[model samples]
Target: MNPEVNEDKSSLYNKVVEGKAQVYFHKTKNEVFYNPIQEFNRDLSISVMNTYSNVNNNKKLKILEALAASGIRSMRYALEIENIEEILANDFDQKAVDLIEENKKLNKVESLVKSNCDDATLLMNSMSRNWKSKFDCIDLDPYGTPAAFLDSAIRAIRSGGLLLITATDAGVLCGNGADTCFTKYGSVSLRTPACHELALRILLQSINSHAARYSKYIVPVLSLSIDFYFRIFVLVYDGQMKAKESINDIGFFHVCPECHTFYQQNYGKTVPTRGNVKFVFDSTSPYDLNKCQNCEGTLKLVGPVWTGKLHDKIFIQHLLKYLNTKTTDDFKTRERMIGMCNLAYEELDNPLYYILDDICSVMHCETPNHNVMRSAIMNCNYQVSYSHCAKNSIKTNAPSEVLWDILKRWVELKPVKEKWMGPEYRLARILKTQPKIQVDFSIRSDCTPESKKNNLLRYQEPPPFWGPGSKPKRKAEDEENSKQQNEKNQKVIEELK
Candidate 1:
């Protein structure tokens, strides 16, 4: 039966199976919610938690699925992840929590999982008030943006705890609604070819800002721009000194609208000393931030994004090691997990990326092969890699001058049919000045990344898309009923527990 269809008011539903658990979803009404396309999301969450469990085997985990509409993910965590002491499957709707309770029994994980009905933010804030009530891992995968619950979620996790966040409001976070993003996340998001990655950074910066409220900071274990949403796993730790260091990670991107070249301006800087690196913030500007140095076009200033590393290299290496031991049936998206992790590991330690096709479009030239472009940049003695963010992305430490020079060299080899040599044409404006740096188009043997050579699935084949704020909510009365149930949910939790 289609999970989205509404059937007769009778208690009729279909059983759905994913990973190691089966749960019932209403064929008619809103007792609980389920989306089969989230299998990859659930699988990757399990894989990451399993890896986290292995790496931190000594500690027992207290996990909370903050928005457990169907409790499928919470059940899977109980059944699959190791070293777990207990799991709280929480939802605002009492009916959803009731289904969670039933599913816990059906899955025979009754001892490990408990159902709770309460507003997610209220539950988390209550947990934050007590040291023992705080969770070791908190997963928030609400329909649209998770912004409404971030502060409470950050405060509720234990130090060195893991916080998994899912954001499906791609429109708001991807620059379609800059004012909304700023209102929701306290950061303005811009439209760019690398908007996915920008979304990741914006979310991280928001979480990081929230973390600072309690003298805590985040270390991103894995930051991904997945199919329909952005899923990020970050480890939270508390220390005033360490929290102070997060300043180095906060920054903005100055993008050239014409040529698509980007320059990052970090809010803080770190200067290498003889013994220890000194942390500095509000430092003097290193790059001319007023305008695009290359094209002289107006530079659009974007973000107060997380300028720090998106993925933990060592953690991803171990994740790949963990995936190598798992079978396809064990995790259907295992290859994708491994592939994405590989690409994340190989990504240059840089902020944002330029899409090759977008750049070629600006130059009005034939698109050069990724390998050839990558080779030219690498041959220039700069590290280069594919941002797990985009297929034709160029993520390198090469200065904009070298990249523009390479494009000039490409135009030299395969010239544009017609050059619109006018001030108005972006192409003319970009190529008007001679390339100051030498560019070599010599193809190298290792141009293709290992992830590509191995035929790994580096990009997503997105599931059915959802518009902004759309996650299959019920009609108005049902939503109001859910709200009323949530308002009084906390009062009845004692009986459920």
Candidate 2:
């Protein structure tokens, strides 16, 4: 489990203070691991752990930071969370572990925080061999996909323990590379506006499938798709039957690439009888994706993603409620967390969301305000909610046909440009069809969400040109020379222009 490498940094700070932990690193040379923007990520994790401890009988917890980096998160856990027996902050790089050691001492949490320089997966694998030594909670915040560690993570967690995972490979998970997504997460990701939500589901299914191999199953507590990555929290429990039943949540997404209509079909079926519900193999109907039922566009298959509930309603409510306690008053991301939690709590259990703009773009019509769209959906007596992932998102139970019907009615009032009305186009196929129901666009008071009404930070804008910062180049001396050379080259090019 030990690694041998040049102690080169995935870099660290001169002195960066976050929460109650103050970290000190030897050099600021080549930046790699530390991200100040993730302060919100840290605060959210602490709040969730606090809520978890409170909800789970205040049991003292043993935690593992699988990729500890500079140990900021571990140190924060040791300080902020109420009941913490110990934390093992492990990183393969010797320098990172050394930095962790120094920061743990600096934070004055040496007793509760331990630093380990070993391969994270191998260390967890070894711990998984000993049933009693498994961690109560394990956090995986790797540079890219957490899929590499998911198997060991699933096996290394104690029964009913929390598993926090982060995946930042948004490009692959959002469908730019479906094959790569399959290689990492064993699912096909689709390119759609709801890609973030799709990414969350894909990761959840990946973890659940890995757990299924060892007769365990996951119960997702909260799942979030943040600015550049996906963070998911799920509880692991040991049960052969429950693991078998996980198939009910495993499914594929059928999408119309042109129009962005989607349908979710699970591998298992729910059979509800007089007084009981039964889970059975899906034998009655097998979907054949030939064309979009709404616009006759080509149907593309994208899945097998987790089709189950992304968050436990009660748990999300508990998290939102935890923010109000006096202990969390110092949280810097408190308002943002509150807004996200409110959205997650209000989010429908539907599989995917439609962007109102994306839908209207097909018709070349003006996009209705989200409130207007919300009111229209409610007027049709269908349930709807906002997905926390995207603004202008419409997560609803209404079928695509119904949605097209409403759009058809809208076009009747305010027609689209004649140039877009070609009979061969998807727009024409949709609008030429007759409306099935009486469409209503009357605005409703309840259409405005509570989060919006209170002006909570529902959609915080990322800093301009935001990204995970780049890795530091060669040495400080070489970097200086390269910078000068690039500047001189740029000056010559500018003069030529």
Candidate 3:
């Protein structure tokens, strides 16, 4: 029976048995066998499994799959992850529990897997006295928002525990339905080209802030965007410093459409900008959108978001090594997982300008001018723009057109402001007048030779990618180039003297 058919087959849904998936209906004596849709919950469960399996030294880890639904996720954890010692699958539905029980027995893994019929929220809330600090990994895959279970989930995970949350309600997070997200998560979602990423960041920030309210801190290890679901894995640490650090890294901000301006104040730096124009009425209030002056586009207000980069290269490399040694088709989903991982990895550092000059170096892709490269990178979801001043381009996390507008403002101003104030300070003042740029988050892409030298100094990569040949060639080029650059610097210094 096809579960999608929705013919009272909820209890009789079939599952994979052994390597080949077999569907056995308990309600009827008939056994139907066929391949399942790749888009089913099972596929998601596999992705979740593959991610956690990347966790190192999990031998003593206690894993919980709250709202275990079909218990497929729990079973995957129990059977696949050798590091996981204790696996708990909890669901309020007694019938689902029974099915889980049967599934565990069918796989002959009853000893490793435990099935419980109880409210997942209750189970998580009781961790204070019942489990205290027992669990290491808590998976929360709910039917919708997952906000209702957040409080309990936070309490359940131990210090240095891993919390994997999945929110399928993308509409709310993307600001398509802002009122709903505000009511549910106490966060304002923004609508923009980067809305998808903004939604995930807001959800992560909500979790971090919610955890901090209880004196907890969370450092995100990996965040993935898969179809309609948003998955975030965070590590919980105990201590006020940890809590403050986590909260400090995630924040809220607003953008103005009319002026192509934005205002972002970190957790500790909360001073309101003193200017004639103000996009944000409240310093710590929810985010909102306004109208753009230049283009008349509705400015998107984004945030209540995370600031830290997503994928940890160390973690990804470890997982890649593990995959290389494995002889199973289990690595089938590796391509998709790696794609998301690479995106997160690339975004870990402060995103810099992909100028026509730098594009060839970073991506090894050639372009004619800043205009063409800017257009291409923007199409690839990267914010890119051009300038005629010291640094001729800038690229960052904000949306492309928004950044372009800011660049235009700076261009018209022609190196505006006092020489004493830095780029960020001058940019902030410029944003004060142009409220549209005030709401977007951006960083300077002014890459000097010294900075480029520093970046190359600490560049890390796979063996073949960063082998002797790679650096030797670049080192030879840099040595010869460095001499000329030093001479030019000396000429300027002598002229100043």
Which has the greatest lDDT? 2
- The number of residue pairs in model 1 that clash at the backbone is 1
Candidate 1 Cα errors over 4 Å, as ranges: 1-11, 29-31, 272-277, 463-472, 475-497
Which lDDT tens digits does candidate 1 get at residues 462-488?
655533232445554677898889877
The C-alpha stretches of model 2 lying farther than 4 A from their native spots are: 1-13, 272-278, 283-288, 326-329, 471-497
Q: What local distance difference test score does each model get?
A: 0.85, 0.86, 0.56
Cα-based RMSD of candidate 1: 8.1
Clash count for candidate 3 is 21
The estimated TM-scores of all candidates read 0.91, 0.91, 0.62
TM-score of 3: 0.62
Counted clashes in each candidate structure: 1, 1, 21
lDDT of 2 by residue, 1-497 (tens): 11422243334347777787787655555633567778878999998988888899998899999998778899989988999988999998877887787787678999999999899889999999776789999999988888899999998999999999888899999999999999998899988989999999999999999999999999999999988888899999999988988988888888998889887777877677788767888834355568787777798888889999999999988888789773434687888888888899889998899999999998799888888888999999998899999988999999878888888888878889988899867787776568889989999988887888988889888767566554334355687899999999999999999
**Candidate 2 or 3, higher TM-score?**
2
lDDT of 1 at 213: 80
Query: Residue 256 lDDT in model 1?
Result: 76
Question: Model 3, which residues run further than 4 Å from truth?
Answer: 1-13, 17-58, 130-133, 256-263, 269-300, 348-371, 374-497
By lDDT, rank the candidates, best first. Answer: 2, 1, 3
Go through the candidates in order and give the C-alpha RMSD of each one to the true structure.
Answer: 8.1, 4.9, 20.7
